[model samples]
Target: MVDGAIAGAVGSAALNVVSYLDVAVRARPTSSTPEETVGRLAGLAHVDLGPEDRAANRRSGLGAVLGYAVGIGAGAVLGALAGTRRMPLAVGTALLGGATMATTDASLAVLRISDPRTWRRSDWMADLVPHLAYGMAAAATLNRLRPPSARCG
Candidate 1:
């Protein structure tokens, strides 16, 4: 149970680190204008937007991190309670984390705050890597707590 809790915490930490990396990458200058950079990042992350949206994406990204913290907390509690049934906890937590990000990004878009339309492939590529890394870490960490009966080995 202790191990499961630790693993869950580690998984959440991994997600946080990856998210931070994504932010750092986006902070770097690209061909994108300042106004477009935020919106472009939101688009790359699959968040929809409109002219009336005024939410600050960078701040929302911070909120995404907070949401990840909640997901991790939930996962750790579930993992500890479920013991050998960690796989579901892990998968659920991972999905929750993703959903949190999508929600946060979308909310910001609703307020009209976004990146420039000229977001480059390189910028998006940099962002993609961190998200993938975070997902992998989350999966691996949660796998440790999965029951033998789970589909995963």
Candidate 2:
């Protein structure tokens, strides 16, 4: 569990670094999908986020936090599984990336936050690269933390 938490934090950090770098390089606006999703969920749950003026800001902040939470949660799950079933590096990386993408896409689609089907090639690439980095970092970290005898091929 401790190893999983550490791996998750490291993985989430990697994701954030990639995202920030992309923003710096492209000067593109950050996606509001997270915020929108938060708002939608809040609406559904009838959770009032204070007054309208403060609600938007709170939602935006919470949205970013939620992204990190998801990353960490995913990493923890991956780490836990890796402990019991050894996976090759390549396979582990792919699994982490795919899992992360699937979780995000499913949440967004179900909440009507964004439809990946409508995303441009550039948009897809933008999302993919960082996630790949995240997967690599996470998988590598988790593998390194395992005992030599337990490490996968």
Candidate 3:
């Protein structure tokens, strides 16, 4: 569990770094979908976030928090499932990336924040690159933390 969470944090960092680099290179504005998702969720829960400005601030922070929760949760799940067993790196990374991407995309679609079907090629690329980085980092970290008695793929 601890290993999973640590791997998740590392994965999240990689995702963020790649995302930031993409933004820097493309000069694109950051996505507000995360914050929008936060607002929609809060509305559903009937939790008032105070004033307009305050609510916006809260959403921003919570959006980021939600991201971390997902990352760490994904990692924890991975650890539980993998245990001493390891998947081939190619297989593992794709599974991890696809799983994370699905979770995020599904959540956003469910919240009516964004429609995957409508995303542009560039948009997909922007999302995919960072997520792949996440998978690579998280999978590698988990493998490294495994005992030398690690199970063969």
Candidate 4:
């Protein structure tokens, strides 16, 4: 249990680091109309998007935390069910997470929030690597450190 908990914490921290890096990367100026690009980046990074119906895709910080809690809970449950076979369970969780992420991002688009498709190279580079690292590290830790409760089945 301690190991599982540790892994979860490490994974969450890693993901948050990725999140910050993604924010920083998107803040850089580009070759496009600098003003418009900056404005869009600013809007994407720190807009009150939840208030406007057209851009109500923004989830509160607490809401995002709750979402992560849900994800962790789901992962823990799945890991327990799958027992020591942590790889498969983690992969399942990652797949599930990816689906959830895509759906959330799509909702953001529907609400006129940030469009990842238009993300600059830095944005993609910063975001992708960290998330991948997060997934892999999380999976490795959870799978490798199977909790006692998970050892039964």
TM-score versus the correct structure, for each prediction: 0.44, 0.92, 0.96, 0.50
- Supply the TM-score for candidate 2: 0.92
Candidate 1 residues 13-84, lDDT tens each? 775576566667668532223235445556779876544444555534545555455446545665565556
Off by over 4 Å in 3: none
Question: Total clashes, candidate 3?
Answer: 0
Q: What lDDT tens digits, residue by residue, belong to model 4 across residues 51-149?
A: 454342333334445445644653455455555654564564465346435644565556555678898986656545655555655666676676434
Candidates 2 and 4, the one with greater TM-score: 2
* lDDT value, residue 140 of candidate 1: 63
- The lDDT per prediction is 0.52, 0.82, 0.88, 0.52
Q: Model 4: runs farther than 4 Å from truth?
A: 1-9, 21-64, 70-74, 77-81, 88-100, 147-153
TM-score-superior candidate, 1 or 3: 3
Prediction 4 TM-score vs. true: 0.50
> How many Å off is the CA of 150 in candidate 1?
2.3
Cα shift from native, residue 14, model 4 (Å): 1.0
Q: Give the TM-score of candidate 3.
A: 0.96
Better of 1 and 2 by lDDT: 2
RMSD of 1: 9.1
Off by over 4 Å in 1: 1-9, 19-67, 70-101, 115-118
